[model samples]
Target: MPEAIQFVPYVLVVLLTGIPTWKLLVRVGLSPAWAILCLIPAGFIIVLWLIAYRRWPLLEE
Candidate 1:
């Protein structure tokens, strides 16, 4: 096995989680800029998501 292959799973996980996170954020008042904070490399995304969801009302179903 190659070293790069080992990271493939982690990379896939980021994309998988990122997509839905972005969609959920976009559903609320946050702009795409804020929603895409999930792409950042730290707890910033999780904290932002939590705050945003807590602050904004649900936009739709």
Candidate 2:
């Protein structure tokens, strides 16, 4: 396996993605428990909530 690189930019991305993900769920009227999971891959989001939250803002066609 290739060694993982630990750089400032990569760490920043992790913090940026993880923090507001918690807040976004509240804004959307969803439970806090689901916010952290929002940080997961978009494919999982699509699969999990497809029938309800059908609009995928970031996903490519």
Candidate 3:
């Protein structure tokens, strides 16, 4: 049971980072679920590159 406590902070961190990331992706016309990528090792970089190079839907208008 004690070991489970160690993961609480990590879960909080993921939620803190993920919620805003999800919102940002949505605003940029990407799926909010893409924010789940940020939870993986080095996945934030992958998402960053994808967002940087991909054309935003808002800009198309």
User: Which one is best on TM-score?
Assistant: 3
- Report the poorest 10 consecutive residues by lDDT, candidate 3: 41-50
Evaluate residue 9 in candidate 3 and report its C-alpha lDDT on the 0 to 100 scale: 87
Best-to-worst order by lDDT is 3, 1, 2
Model 3 over residues 3-60: C-alpha lDDT tens digits?
9999998898788878888888887888888898879758777877877888888899
1-61 per-residue lDDT for model 2 (tens digits): 2345546655566467656655655555555566455445573364346325744344434
For each candidate in turn, give its C-alpha RMSD to the true structure in angstroms. 3.8, 8.4, 1.5
lDDT by residue for model 1 (1-61), tens: 6998999987787687677666766766565555455555674467465755575675343
Worst 10 residues of 2 by lDDT: 43-52
**TM-score ranking from best candidate downward:** 3, 1, 2
Model 3: lDDT to the true structure: 0.84
lDDT of 2: 0.52
- Per-prediction TM-score: 0.57, 0.41, 0.78
lDDT of 1: 0.64
